[model samples]
Target: MYQYDLIDKEFLADRSAEFRGQVARRLSGELTEDQFKPLRLMNGLYLQLHAYMLRVAIPYGSLNSTQARRLAQIARDFDKGYGHFTTRQNIQFNWIKLKDAPEILDKLAEVDLHAIQTSGNCIRNTTSDPYAGATAEEVDDPRVWSEVIRQWSTLHPEFSFLPRKFKIAITASAKDRTAAKVHDIGLMLRKGRDGTLGFEVIVGGGQGRTPYVGPTINEFLPTDRLLSYLEAVLRVYNRHGRRDNIYKARIKILVAALGAEEFARQVDEEWAKIDAARADLPTAELARIRAAFAKTPFETLPARSDAFETAKANDAAFARFVRNNVKPHKQPGYAIVEVSLKAQEQTPGDASAQQLEVVADLAERFSLNDLRVTHAQNLVLPHVKLDDLPTVFATLQASNLATPNIDLVSDIIACPGLDYCALANARAIPVAQDIARQFADLDRAEKVGELKIKISGCINACGHHHVAHIGILGVDKKGEEFYQLSLGGSGAEDASIGKILGPALPADKVATAVDQLVGAYLNVRNDGERFLDTYRRVGLEPFKEAVYAQAD
Candidate 1:
């Protein structure tokens, strides 16, 4: 994890002080709600349906134990007893009081965390592979580049306010764990023909009402010219992107209008004008950032752990947990453990203050004081030793955090919809909870295997429903809530938008409709075919027929 320097500390302190004065003026009746809206939004505060919500950015989804502990403290002291981990790998406090917002920011700054650029039409958190440093499949740790982008983008004078909010995701691995293709700028670190690692830059990809899988603007860009190239891309968007209509303000919309070839050509033209040496990070500065994420010290041990194997053999629950939550790590005797926040009948992506504390403690004790928040709305202990599995599992089980359902049907990704958001048309959390309860049986859920069900409250696609294997978009039908179901979507290496099945079903029927779709998939699937594979092979007819037929 990157440590905050004096400059970072001083910048945060000044920002916090400025916000404190702003909040005081608002409270003193000098500023109306309308007058304070933009100011609050700039600090990642939103006025939701129920109360104020504050979003804290977790840059590249990286958190040290100290930072995690501060987040838990914020949850306990300022807002509700729990916080929601969002699809962007940030955390949101749904029940925040306006008066406490500045204080919370101050607290966050103490741990090198803040809510800046979490909202209001700027580059949000630069998300990356959660397993960045721990996975063997990666070319190099993506976080180093993510941090470089973060430093460059944070409060940049030229691109501070664009046509709309922008997102960027990077991945060093061949597998697309960060859903890079769905971002405005997706950078894949790969080897060029000369065998030197560089970025394959894709631009204009986004979800929301008008979804697009961003096109490859540059097939291979040298690592040294990353900032210069990004500057060119942003400059093009800033100059030509739509600003007249809020609906079509995204860079994706601009990209669509110009076409990928024209867009790339313009970017290249813009790139030619900029000084690459000045724009790109110096080699020494890059080395400083890279050194901050040095490999964790590990004891030499055998590849397999006898204690872990024995625990799995003796305890069925532990065995199931290992199968579901434990992921392969680069180190011989270490494992990457995913902590699923979506337990049966609970809201997905929410963790209580105590649960957060538990995770922080676990990370400090077993995982080199590091934790990662995933885009799937889960927390990861990135370097747990194989021998510590039983102890970690036991602690998680006690805290109701051991929900052996990673990538399973019950492991849903949903946004805080009508329950909190003012922009929501329907309640996404309840629908997710109901469906999760329906598949509460672990045996049945495991059989359903590797199914990603993403639900969005509206067309903004905050929940990333467009890329889910089973995507549910909640819509307003008359005065009631109806869900539009889509199938065969994926956010993986094979990225594709899902096709809608039929008419939107009422909220009550959504779970049953999902059940029908799953049943249809199970009936038609061949040997070792997952739901996505079956849906792709068979197309939408079978699932559509099954769902609508049952409705009729």
Candidate 2:
């Protein structure tokens, strides 16, 4: 993880002091709610339907044990006893008090964490593959570049307030764990024919009311010129992006209005004017950032762990957990363990203070003090030793974190919808909880196999329903909550937007509708076919017919 230098520390202190003064003024009646809206938003504070919500950025989803402990402390002291991990790999404390906002920021700064750019129309946290340095599949650690983007984008004078909020995700692996296709700028690190590293740049991808899979603006951009190219792209958007209408303010909208070819042409023209030498990072600075993410020290060991194998053989519960939560790691004797926050009938992406502390302790004791927050709203102990699997699993089980459902039907991704957000139309968390409870049976859930069900409260798509295999979008039908279902969406290497199935069903019918879709999939699926594969092969008609037929 990148450690904060004196300059970084000083900057945060200044920002915290400024916000403290702002909050005091607001509380003193000098500033109205409308007057303080933008100021609060700039600090990642939102006045939700119930109370204030504070979002804390976890850059590239990286967190040290110390930082994780600090987050748990904040959950316990300032807000509720839990925090919600978001789709962007950030954490949100939903039940925050406005008076404590500045104090929370100060606490976060102590651990080199902050909530800046987590809201408002600026580049949000630059996310990357959660298994960045731990996986062998990636060309290099994508976090190195993500950190570079963070430093460059944070409080940049020129692009501070764009048409709308922008997001960037990078991945070095061909598997696309970062959902690169659904970001404002998706950078895929790859080696060229000459063996020089560069990026395949995808632009204009986003999900909201108007969803788009960003087009490839540049097929190959050298690593050295990343900043210059990004600058060019943003400059084009800043100059020509829609600002008159809030609905069509995103860069994706601009990219859509102008054809991809014309957009590429304008970016190229803009790139020619900027001096690459001035815009790009110096060689020394790049090396410094790369050094911060250097490989973790590991003991020499054989490929297989006898203890791990024995534990799996002896304990059926442990075996199930290994099959679901344990992922392959680059190190010979280590495994990447995903701790699911979506326990049965609980809110997705939420962790209690005790659960967070347990994870922090586990990371410190067994995983070299390194932790990662996945875009799927789960935690990753990226370097747990194979021999420590039993201990880790036992601790997680005790903490209620061991929900053997990674990428399973019950492992849902849902946003804090009408439960908290002022922008929401209907409740997403309840729908998600109901569906999770419906599929709580492990045998049945495992039988369903590798299904991703994402739910969004409204058209903003914060829950990323546009790219889920089975998407549920909550809507209001004459003041009653209803859900519109979509199928075959994926946020992966094979990125595609899901098509809507039929009319919206009432909230009560959603879980049943999802069950019908799953049953239809199981009936028609060929040998070894997952839900997505079956859906792709059979198309939407079969599943749509099954869901609506049952509803009727």
Candidate 3:
């Protein structure tokens, strides 16, 4: 929804042109693979197992239909027929050619999109709640702060090339949909004592080798001082974070070693030295940014849509979809419609070029020309008219994008795994596909209710397996693929790392083990309890027993 200003357009043009020259030199033998590695990474290009991968950043998960159409075009022409939407709310093209990379970047720049800061040891995409402006629960739109951080952190001289890659997620809602706690820096927007807006800053939250939920560094950092506080935290991490061991290089490790109190003290000391006014955004700039995100022209209507209710009452499928895929909007007669990419037996987040185009068209027609990418690998038409639900559903159904399995077991989150990523030890997509096929019954999936199954190829936790209700990690055992399961994990406000159930199961046995675990949950769950609620209430013993019993 935020239009690119002249400066923004100029910056992208300049950056794209510069990258084009760099790419030309690399392709012409002036730069070897080793020489081009860092350069390519800086621009979000990765040489995967089969081909080069290009990750394009969708800032704070917001994009216009024009941008969406451009992405579809890129998926159609440049790389493959589809693009993978990631947990970071970014898009990854798996079959990118090194030679076509520059042209792709240029094309992205045309639509005010690029892969800048999508990779390397800098602040990655600053994500926020997808329902930012649409949700009524938020204190303020987190995208306002997210954009501020994005503009400030992009190519900042002091924080570039940290000990490890840094991530920052912000959310204003009481419900933490952004997985804020798993980021290197998590900014929870809140109102202070006098009703003034501020951030409850959490530092050192990460989920890789050593999973950690960032502890609260500042109980209340005033809105104006956000940048200054963030600077102080980054400065502290940069000064003392591990450099000798890449595994221990993340800020989370530093925070754990030093303790939260000491980390907070250090950040405070650093904050005291810096001139806050100099680092903080000016009022004019803040106002300008806020103005860009002003509310859309939502019509004044009654509390409920008669047409929507009538359709829901008439059609079972529509009713089921309404129950699962449609979310309440802050505006009356409007809905936040989730376009699920996780269809039965499909790769979780893979959207075909045609599917992308269809979504773009739908967004332009129904969602005020704005679309949002959720952290859960789903797309959101954040402001769809309730009366248009049937038409929207029919269009999506035709395109195979209307999957009513949000937060269900079959609605899995999975990484590229051995299929595309070089770091992966096992194939995650096939495993996810198997599980989805096993539980293809929509009624059965809805009965299971709100189960998040996240899969990762390796411990890198790209799929955010660390925070799923049911976490699966793929490991290589003597050249054979094995799947390890974890339980009681969540990425919500009550964020927690999953606990391992038992030994890793063989690849072929994973689906059976998952079924057994689900059965155990159903057996032990209380009335109206979801999988996570049941897991939290009963602990992992029941599920573990059920799984191991099947093995025995």
By lDDT, the best candidate is 2
Model 1: lDDT equals 0.93
Q: What's the CA error at residue 40 for candidate 2, in Å?
A: 0.9
Q: Tell me the spans in candidate 3 whose CA falls farther than 4 Å from its real position.
A: none
TM values, all candidates? 0.99, 0.99, 0.99
Clashes of each: 0, 0, 0
Poorly placed runs, candidate 2 (over 4 Å): none
lDDT of 2 by residue, 1-552 (tens): 788899999999999999999999999999999999999999999999989999999999999999999999999998779999999999999999989999999999988999999999999998899998889999989999999999999999999999899999999998998889999999999988899999999999999999999999899999999999999999999999889999899989989999888999999999999998899999999999999988578878788999999999999999999999999999899999999999987799999999999999999999999999999999999999999999999999998899999999989999899999999999999999899989989999989899999999999999999999999999998998999999999999899999999899999999999999999999999988999999999999999889877556
Which 10-residue window of candidate 3 scores lowest in summed lDDT?
Answer: 295-304
User: Model 3 clash pairs?
Assistant: none
- Tens digit per residue, CA lDDT, model 3, 249-283: 99999999999999999999999999977999999
Q: RMSD per prediction, one decimal?
A: 0.8, 0.8, 0.9
Which residue segments of model 1 deviate by more than 4 Å?
none
lDDT of each: 0.93, 0.94, 0.92
Q: Write candidate 1's Cα lDDT for 1-552 as tens digits.
A: 788899999999899999999999999999999999999999999999989999999999999888988998999998778999998899999999989999999999998999999998888899999998999999989999999999999999988999899999999999988999989999999987788989999999999989988899998999989999999999999999889999899999999999999999999999999997889889999999999888577778789999999999999999999999999998899999999999877789999999999999999999999999999999999999999999999999999999999999989999998888889999999999989988888999898888999999999999999999999999998889999999988888789999998899899999988899889989999989999999989999999999887667
